[model samples]
Target: MGISENINEILLDIKKLSPYPEKVNLVAVTKYVDVETVKEVLKSGAHILGENKVQVLTKKHDELWDYSVNHKWHFIGNLQKNKVKYIAQFIDMVHSINKLSLAQEIDKRAQEHNRVIDVLIEINLFQEDSKEGYDYQDFLNDIPALLTLKNIKIKGLMTMAPYTDNEDLLRNGFKKLRDLKDELNTLYFNDSLTELSMGMSNDYKIALEEGATLIRVGSKIFE
Candidate 1:
């Protein structure tokens, strides 16, 4: 099957799991693909594209200028403070605001661009040493500080489950993220936290079952 077919299949699967399929955003991860492939993805009907690197995203944004009005760009990797300026102008949503300092920098850049940026606080649910995100307890402690940043709207939480075939582990991880989002909204953000960027190509189905509003899928769609 081609990109279009893959997207259709994924959308169908999403509909199977989610009652409100329209609310689930399918972000086609285009980090490994070239501009031509990305254009094909957009043409295939996956209008929301996610890029991991600032340089690649900037380059693709320029090359795919015509799709700007209809498509949106999401920064899905570990965003650096300095690199925030490059994407601030066009990034529709950032799925990994990992630290307080990074949030401050995004706020500054968004202010410079005269636009408020949408962002998700990345939570290291399992305390993985390899991951770049706030520890679960740390994030809870810093909620007040994160809320103080005026230019970036905290959409919700994002997490990448460990790459394992264990279905139970995946479901639990995704559930934890969903619960955290609900807790944060009820206690701190007042139900404003909406998007849960939890799923990827590997465990997106489980993530969707648990309540993932945004799922980042790459190789599956491109293959």
Candidate 2:
């Protein structure tokens, strides 16, 4: 199937799971794909494209200058402090902020650009050695300090469930993220914590069912 067909199929799936499909953000993961492929997805109405590396995002951002005005670019990988400068001016949001120091650096870069950068706190639900994010207790303890940052807005939470054929495990991880988001809202009295950036091509349907506001899909669409 073509990019358009794949996107339509994904949208249909999202509709089946989401109470309000219009509100759900579909971010197409563009890492490793060429600019032409990225444009193909964008042309198919996948306006939000996520890139894992800042250098790649910068190249694509420049290559797709005309389309950039119409689409949103997201940094969805392990962002390094020095690399933050590359995306500071163009990235629409950062979806992998796990530490206060990284958040502080992002804020500093955003300050330099005179823009407020939207960010999601990545939660390491199972403390997996491979994933990067804050544990529950650390997140809670850092809330006050996170709130003190002026240039970064705490949008919500993001998590990557273990890649498994087990549906139960997938649902559990996504559920925890939703629960944490709710808890944080009540504890912090911040209603802006609305986005739940969970799920990918493998388990996005489950993610939607569990209340993921932003679903990052890659291979399925690109294939």
Candidate 3:
């Protein structure tokens, strides 16, 4: 299988541009793309893969049956408490850990599977009434609730900037998440909350510039 040169080029570019140690986890979002395509991406040296829907991920996870390396799977979409068991089984990380109840379920399921699940708390930057993310104002109040959840460990904060092309809004939103991570870190998490998961294919570079330790990229690579 041949790897995508275009994707590799972008990864090379991103790897070089990142100032912090090459420690960031570049999650290759494989939503619309095919499993064989992802295999080629894996061949291109991508260790982590991200999926949006649990059902879709379940299929992808089964289809990619024999990847030999440390291929980690990440759930990057809104996860319901009911789907916790399936996700905890194979996903190495969960990026959209929203409700505290969902987090509790994940902790319980992960513990059942004897695994430590890494998670990123999602904050709704757009403030959309329909969106499922912790609001900025309520964040401090919710910290204790988040900490009490079991088995799952918070790696950092994740936020999806409103779907707009506004550079200013994007910057401020990304910066806010970074700042939130800093504020959260001022306290201790025993395990440590060190990752700031922001940005996608469109604004990942800006996110990297703003201290995002994890970038969930899709179309840029999968296309």
The TM-scores, one per candidate, come to 0.97, 0.97, 0.91
- Candidate 2 lDDT over 1-223, as tens digits, reads 8889999999888899987787898999999789988888888988999999888899999999876437989999999988998899978999999899999999998999999999999999967899998888998888889999999999999997888899998898899888989988988946779899999999999999999989999998977
Worst 10 residues of 1 by lDDT: 62-71
Pairs clashing in candidate 3?
Answer: none
Tens digit per residue, CA lDDT, model 1, 118-193: 9999988867789888887888777889888889999898997888899998898888888888888889989999
Off-target runs (Cα >4 Å) in candidate 2 are: none
Report the number of the highest-lDDT candidate: 2
lDDT of each: 0.89, 0.90, 0.80
Question: Distance (Å) between predicted and true CA of 92, model 2?
Answer: 0.6
Question: Model 3 compared with the native: what TM-score?
Answer: 0.91
lDDT at 71, model 2:
91
